[model samples]
Target: MQLTILRSQLLSGLEKVGRAVNSRSTLPVLAHVFLEACDNRLSFFATDLETGIVMPVSAEVKTPGRTTVPAGPFTEYAKTLPTQAELTLTLKDGKLTVKSGASKASFATGDPGDYPPRPTLAEADHTFTLLPGVLKDLLRQTLPVTATDEARAILTGVQFDAAPAQLTLRAADGFRACVAQAGYESLPLAPFQAVVTARSLREVLRLLDGTHPEAVQIIADQQARVAFLLAEGVIVFAQTLAGEYPDVDQVVPKTATTEAVLSVEAFIRACKQMRVAADKPREALGRLDLQNSGANAVKVTAEGEILTASETTLTGDVTVTGQSMQIALNLAFVLDMLEVIKTSHVRLKANAPNTPVVLTPEGVPGLLYVIMPMVGH
Candidate 1:
């Protein structure tokens, strides 16, 4: 393969597909980036068995061919070159040569035959489209709640449910669950469900930033492979986990014995301050002492093990209803939800001390977050 491309473009394409490169794979080629120079365009491909990514860029192709080279060292070398310099890549006798200005580097090429080929999604199956911003929001909110336990592989992925009128995303890690949905105009196919790994979801988000595609086209085949198509032929594909995702709706509390609305900024600040104290405990759970201070006010007290290193803030506009309560919860989890909530204020609903607390933004529709309370000694 012989090609002349801008250093910046090459770096961008390399970074895009590098997410799927398995640097420690038993097969050496899996850690390398596959380059195909053809049709005045250069394409990069990488896969780690479960997930794969393809990215293409405009280039001046001198000779149309293909080659595979280690991604790590080549990417690092490209980063050190001038961004606007023209980078020339040539393959001869299984050795890849890189030249720009006065600097030159050579890397041993891997056998291109060993690189896994890209999987294609049937065009007929690629009918569903979702707004990039909306999809990005859904992933940001739900991915954090996915379980990391490999034994329950299903919980490690974000579940996508496409109904007749609305599309929903749900995730649960046993301790907490998140459900987010948005209404759609039409259905490309019948209602269906699939689970995509959280890692793949993050990669899709990254690709959306670079491509900023109009809408993400989703395709799920009978073989359980899922693919997201972006602009410029950029695609993120992965194998769906085999199993049923837990019913998250049942875990959300329908009724609340206590409810409070607090300023999102203030609540997050209090949680962070308390988290500093909570970090001392073995369990790493933060303690929240909520009590009705007055009509439209709730005193939030954050205490540590000594209880003397406590901070109290009387949150205003706090419309507390029903009974007052104190709950222990994972501060990190609460902070995660707070970071993603798109609202000036957030509503918290709690039924009992041990039950999960439901959180929802004041104006955001079709988004629900539930966190199971922590047990106190």
Candidate 2:
């Protein structure tokens, strides 16, 4: 392979695809990035068997060829070169040479044929288009709820379900669940669902660039894999988890006995102030008390073993139904939900102190979080 690509462009392509290359792979080829120079562009590909990515960057291709090299060292070296410098890459014998300005490096090359075949999806299957902002929001809201336990593989991914007019993202660990919905312009041929790993979704966000190309195409091939096509050249692919996701609609509470409206900032501040005390205990449970202080006001108090915090900031129009109650919940769980809410006011509802608390933005629809209460001593 011979190519003269801009240092910045080469570094960008390498960084984009390097997310799929696992540092600890039993197969050494899996840790290498596949490089192909063709059609006036240099393409980079990497995969860890479960997830893969392909990114193309503009390059001056002198001789079209393909090779593989270690992704980590190559990217580290490229990052040090001047962005204005032109990077010249050439493959001879079994080694690849990289030269830019005064710096030069060589790496052992592997046969590109040894790399795993790139994943592709059929065009006639379930497909849809989502705005980049919508896709990012959906993933951000639900990813935190995904389970870290690998034993329950289904819970480690966010459930992507598409209906006629809307697409929903749902994720749950054992103690908490999050659901977010966004409207899509193009609906799939039929209703489809897939469980995509949280780790892959994070990389997909990075590929979105957060600026250019406002729309993203999603292809869900039940027979193959889930593909997120960003712009026209970049693709992020992930294997769907085998098994059925839990019925999130049924798991979320439909009614509440006590409800209160509070400022997202104020409540979060109270939680942080009390986190020092809450973090000391092995259980890490923070006690919260909600009471109807007066007209259109609800007092929120967070209590820990050694520290206590109370906030009475008449936030919006606070309404409390049923009796006053105190609930113990994971401080980390509550803080996670608050950070992603991005709203002025949030509503908290629960049937009892032992039941799960449902949190939703005051005016946002199709976005809610349910956190199970901790057992208090």
Candidate 3:
């Protein structure tokens, strides 16, 4: 293979596909990137079985050929060269040479045929389109809540529900669940739901965040492989688990008695301060005391006496407490929800001490977080 490419273009292509290269893979070929030069363009491809990415960049192609080289060493080496330098690459006798200005390096090459074939999605059977921003937002909100434990294999993947006009993404790690809903103009009528690995979802988000494409085309087949196509690249992901996700809708409470609308910032700050004290407890529980001070003023007190060696107090007077319940909850979980809420105020509802505590954005009801409470001694 022989190609001359601008350093910036080569680096951009390398970084995009490098995300899928596993540095510590049992199969050595998985650690290498496939470099193919053709038609005045260079394409970089990498796959770790579960996820694959392909990035195409403009290059001056002198000869059409393909080869595989260690991704980590090549990427690190390219980064040190001047950004505007022109990189010349050639492959001969199982060796690859890289020359830029006064610096030159050669690395052993692996047989390109040994690299795994990039999975392709059939364009005819099932397809859908989504605004890149909408899909990116859904991932940002739900991916963090996905279960990482391999024991509950099903919970490791985010559930994608595509209906007629609305798309919803749901993820849970048993203690907390996050559901994000958005509207789409049109969607394909296929399996109403599919479970994709959290790793796949994260990779897609990482790629989209860097490239920021206007829209993305998604293809899913009966084989459970999902592919995302954008302007500059494509990502194909393999589903890790296959099963019916638990009925999250049933877990969301239908009714509540005590709801308090408090400033999100204040609640978050209180939770942060209380975290220091809560950390001292074996279970990391933060106690919240809510009471009706007057017709319109509700007092919120979050105290963590164990960690502080003293009591940590956060008092806030809010307009109302919908249903009053003194609930003990995990401080870290509460703080995570508070940080992500987009509204100025957060509404907290609880039916009982053991029941789930529901948090909703002040004006938005669709996005809801259900956090299970901690048992107090």
Error of 2 at 236 (Å): 0.5
TM-score for candidate 3, residues paired by index: 0.92
Candidate-wise lDDT, in order: 0.85, 0.83, 0.78
Tens-place lDDT per residue, model 1, 179-229, is: 999865346577778899988888998888878787788888776778988
Q: Candidate 2: list runs displaced more than 4 Å.
A: 209-211, 280-283, 293-317
Steric clashes per prediction: 0, 0, 8
**lDDT (tens digit, per residue) of candidate 3 on 323-371:** 5457788877777677766789888888888888888888865688888
- Span of 10 residues, lowest total lDDT, candidate 2: 308-317
Q: Residue 161 in model 3: shift from native, Å?
A: 0.7
lDDT of 2 by residue, 1-377 (tens): 79999998998888889889987988999989999999889999999988899999999999999999999999998888986999899999989999987888999989989989887675538889988888888887898899989989999999998888899999999899998999996777788888998888988887776336668889887555889989748999988888989988787888887888788887777666656666463345666677755555554445554565444344455566666777877878888888987788889898888888999998899999999898763
TM-score of 1: 0.94
Query: Clash number for model 1?
Result: 0
